[model samples]
Target: MHNSKNSYIHTSAKIYGSTTIGENCTVMENVILGYPQQDILLQVTSQGKQIEDFEFHGCDIGSGSFIRAGTTIFSNVRTGSRFRTGHNAMIREKTVFGDDVLVGTNVIIDGNVSIGNNVSIQGNVYIPTHVTIEDNVFIGPCAVLANDKYPVRGEYHPIGPVIRKGASIGANSTLVPGIEIGEGAMVAAGALVTKDVPAWKLALGCPAKITDLPERLQSLNKI
Candidate 1:
């Protein structure tokens, strides 16, 4: 564990491997940083071996981070400065977060995801692998972003949703795999988006229909 100056890590927090906690960070109790990935852990357990013997790629959390209690961050994850997470959030391996990112309580970020600056993901959101969220994106509560169209059936090439800059994914919305939400687009609450939403447009209802965004809502997000 390589902690920078002025960082406050609770004694109960478990930091492993070559993890680096940046300056002025606060890691709360019960937080687990640099936990081995699933595949690595499985392999070690199958052979009745200890995971501590392996040298996994540890995580790097940037300056001014606030990692709340019960959060488990897998190895190989990196986050920019001012990153914050609510209680019980889980960030998997190979996920990258940009500056000023906020992940709410119970949020599950599957590995291989890329999130840009100023992104806010609300509580109970599920972000699958291969997802890309651009700058200033807001993912509301209970939102589900899929990556696999056919799960355990045929040829599996997971391509998650791509949320462009300034896009807002509404609460309880479900985005199907591989769809691109264009820049400045707004998806209405409870909408089930099955295709691409054009830039600055509004998508509404189940199997959402695209429509023009209101004049008052046309402005880019200031997140």
Candidate 2:
């Protein structure tokens, strides 16, 4: 564990192998950083192995991060400066987050995801693997982003959604796999997006209908 200058890690926080916490960061109580992936941990435990027996590719959290209580950040995850998470957020392995990212409470970010700068993921949002969220995107509460098009039927190729820069996904929205939400697009509340939405367009309703964005809603996000 490499804790940089002015970092305050709570006594109850579990920081494992090779993890680095940057300057002026606060790791709150009950937070687990640099935890091994589920399969690896299960294998190790099943074999009665100890912590030092296996090498872990640890996580790197940049300066000014505030990881709230009950958060679990798996190994091989990297986050840029000023990353903040609300309580009970779960960020899995192989995920990368850009600067000024905010993950709200109860958010679950699965592994192998990419997130750009100034992104806001609200509470109860589920982000699956292989998703890419560009800069200044806003994912409202209860939004779910899937990666599996044909779930549990046969050979599965998981391809999640690509949300472009400044896009806003409204509350309770569900994005189907392999779709691209173009730059500055807006997805209205409770929308079930089944296909790609062009740049600066608006997607509304279940099986979302694409339409021209309203003039008032056309401005790029000020996130």
Candidate 3:
């Protein structure tokens, strides 16, 4: 394989067959690509079957995407252009990320997820499977996105959450599943989001409240 200037693939890095990396991309040290896994499990799986091993389909790094040092991207993850990440970020399989996305350090993103463009995901965040994040959204550090509203032993069906467009979730927050956060809404730090958040409102506290709207959206009151 050929190497380009301004693009660094560390000697310690291991890349497997048929991988495509765009121009001006930096693949740092100790990065591993194309781990093995069971087919179509990342997409969806039925019960009574155990996930045996970790597998990778392939990874596509878009142009100008800077993959920081020690970051690991498991197989079948598709990422768009101008993507950047902090050190030691771990992204699991079957995930799709759009252009100009910024992911902070020590972030953990699992499979069956989709993230839109211009999103900012802070450090130490845990994003579980089957979640969808729309465009221009902000997810703060240590935010926990929960998929199960109620857990029962006999019935073990997991459903992931969704963070809508232009929504800003403050640091250390928790979003319960089966709820939609409306466009341009804001959730304050440390709040537990248990319900659907209305558009252009600010929610805070243990169960979250509509304190006020930000100035940008406040203009609607004038009309």
Lowest-scoring 10 consecutive residues by lDDT in candidate 2?
Answer: 49-58
Cα lDDT of model 3 by residue, 1-223, tens digit: 2334567787887764335677888888887654433554443244433333322246777889888888887668778988888998888888899999988899998778899999999999998888999988889999988776676645655567677788888999988876777778888999998888888888899988776776865322110
TM-score for predicted model 3 compared with the true structure: 0.84
lDDT of 3: 0.77
Give candidate 2 regions above 4 Å deviation. none
TM-score of each: 0.96, 0.96, 0.84
By summed lDDT, which 10 consecutive residues of candidate 3 come out lowest? Answer: 47-56
| Backbone clashes, each candidate | 0, 0, 5
Q: What RMSD does each model have against the real structure?
A: 1.3, 1.3, 5.8
Write candidate 2's Cα lDDT for 1-223 as tens digits: 8999999999999887789999999999999999998877887788898765766777999999999999999999999999999999999999999999999999999999999999999999999999999999999999999999889987999999999999999999999999999999999999999999999999999889999998888877888
lDDT score, candidate 2:
0.95
Q: Which pairs, if any, clash in model 1?
A: none
Give the Cα-based TM-score of candidate 1 against the true structure: 0.96
